[model samples]
Target: MQSLVIPLLPELPGLVHASASGTVWAITATLLASAVATPVAGRLGDMYGKRRMLLASLGLLVVGSAVAGLSTTLIPLVVGRTLQGLSAGVIPLGISIMRDELPPERLGSATATMSSSLGVGGAVGLPTAALIADHASWHLLFWISAGLGVLATALVLRLVPESQARTGGRVDLVGAAGLSTVLVCLLLAISQGADWGWASGRTLGLSVVGVAVLVAWGRWELRARQPLVDLRTSARRQVLVTNLASVMFGVATMPVRLVQPQVLQLPTATGYGLGKSLLVTGLVLTPTGLVMMAVSPLSARISAARGPKTTLMAGAVVIAAGYGLGVGLMSAIWQLMMVTTVIGAGIGLAYGAMPALIMAAVPISETGAANSLNSLMRTVGAAIASAVGGAVLAGITITVAGATVPGQNGLRVAMVIGGAAALLALAITTFVPRRRPPASADA
Candidate 1:
């Protein structure tokens, strides 16, 4: 769902009969909704049932896709996207379910595979969405997504069993509201800072309000009987370091997504631009996803043998290496493809290990909320990367003919920053305690 509208972004203004700025809400709404929903859904999954929450999320996706498919205006599309975003908890919930249903011997590989799906979907979806947008009516994209959602819902109902593991507790409505407010305010500020003027009153006010609310929210969570998130668990050295590394990995992942497509599709008249079409750009990046999938088992094996910490550190090293290579090799499509593929492999290794680390630290009862918090940390990292990267790309630009575009220097700088982030992740992972045997779900 994340990549579904990216290919059509340039045309959305015309399609929705709105200004570009107005149509941007379609994208922003999804991010905001996902941020707010992920942890809340996870907590609900723990309290109710993972399968039940999973189904609920899928239902929302189906409804959202259908709404988006039928929309001719920005507001309805944004509403639809928000519903789709509510399904963001599915991945972490799936990971928690694996913890409940799968035996210890199979848990590592199963969770690894499930975790890697994030990259697989995005990488594969990009080309698929691009192809659909290129050949068919754009509405067909959402219709297809809705169909897939239905199929997935059916399959899950038929095959997946609801786990007996449950953390029976009342929902923390107050904590949920507090966290939602914090996320919305902070994300809005981060996401729109460039467009709204970073120093503007609106941006600063939101930032200040978000931080203030966060402090209050932290105190409330600590005092609540059934907190939305277990703050004490999250503050543990293992969980804390792992989440911080996840954030850096998130930052590392963003530049390739943002910079490569622009570099590929920029007019060739720009000295360094490849000038590939959108379809070609998507095809080039497809290998990255394939490589990530192929590396899942390897990630699991390394995590099993050397521990998730080692796997994470190795992945960070590989990602840093990929970005370092990217710095010197931006002129050719094959070079960019090679860079992305290497980075994807690194991501596959890192992503697969992260959940293992989190699960190992938290009890089975808290798996849903714990894993969701980890996912949210990554989301926060991506938001930061997007903001900083946009500033960099926009800050350094050159004119081609009558058009202003990001300069080659800006692309190189972004790659360097990506590499630095990866290295930072590696350094942080070094502080993560070595893995312990995972806690059994029934324990």
Candidate 2:
């Protein structure tokens, strides 16, 4: 829904005119809110109850969707979108819940599927959003989101059991406040840097503040009795290396999402463009999401047979191969689909392995916070990719019909960069400690 807002400009003239930044806020607001809410929700889930926090996240989604569906103005829409973003913790929370509730034998596949849900939702949701926006009223998108949220909430209530594992510590208010401050500043700078000018005072100011606050936040976390994150556990060699590789993986995987649509939708008059309609572009991309789902179990099987470290390295290599293919294969729609599916499979494998790797290093009580932090690392990586990739695309542009469009070489550069990131991830994963025994039942 957030990314969908960009193309929604024509359909939402009234709301756009009402706000200075227009529907762009509808997109950025969600990103910002998701970044902030995810980690906090994880910590809260660890302290109180995963099920309770999960339910609350779902409820926010339900309410947010309904509010956005009914809104006729920009303010209400942004408010609703922000609320929806608050529910971004659902993925990590679900993973943590699975860790607590599932037996070790079943854990690999279940967590893999749960973790892949994040990518699957975005991959599948984009085309669905575009299809609805084209054929039906834009308002219907949120209504459908609301309906799904309600159904998910009910299903979870009926089927999922609350875990007894609890990190019995007082909420670290100062740490939470500091962390939120850091994230908001950093993300705002990255997300808006293009528009504001990367060198502009606002962007530079936020960047500096974010770094300073992050340092302070780290200091506070190390000292707090019950920190928002278990810094020591997170600092473990296994956990630390997994997270570093995840950041690279995040950068490696994001180019498909950022590059494919633009290339597919550009006018064929450009010679290199496919000139597909939004729905068709979406359809071409749909296989990527399906491949992720299809590959999840196989990925889990690989992790079980070898180890998640092996799985992670394999996934990174596959992603690099996919990007290498993309550099040459993007001239045709079918070719692009193949490239995306290949990359998606890699992402599915890597994402599926991440939760297993993290859980194996942290205590059960720390699952929520640990998993959340890992998720946050991926978010940071993706944001950096967006910032850096956008700059690359913007750097080499040709004016088409008086509008700026990225030159073909720009897309190629993105592919090469993505491939490099994946290879870097692969290199980093090579150093991660070999498979340890599954985390102790009582740890």
> In lDDT terms, which candidate is top?
1
Report lDDT (CA) for all predictions.
0.93, 0.88
* Worst lDDT 10-window in candidate 2: 1-10
Encode model 2's per-residue lDDT on 1-443: one tens digit a residue.
Answer: 44555457555666445645566788888988888888899999999999999999999999999999999888899999999999999999999999888887898999988888777777778788888888888888899999999999999999999989987778889988998899999999998899899999999999999999999899989988889987888889899999999899889877887789889999987888888888887788878777888888988999999999999998998999999999999888889999998999999999999998999898888899989989988988898898889989999888888889999999999989999999999999998888786566466
State TM-scores per candidate: 0.99, 0.97
Clashing pairs in 1: none
- What is the Cα-based TM-score of model 1? 0.99
List, residue by residue over 370-438, the lDDT tens digit for candidate 1: 999999999989989999999999999999999999999999999999999999999999999875766
Model 2: CA > 4 A from native: 1-10, 13-15, 18-20, 441-443
Candidate 1 runs further than 4 Å off:
439-443
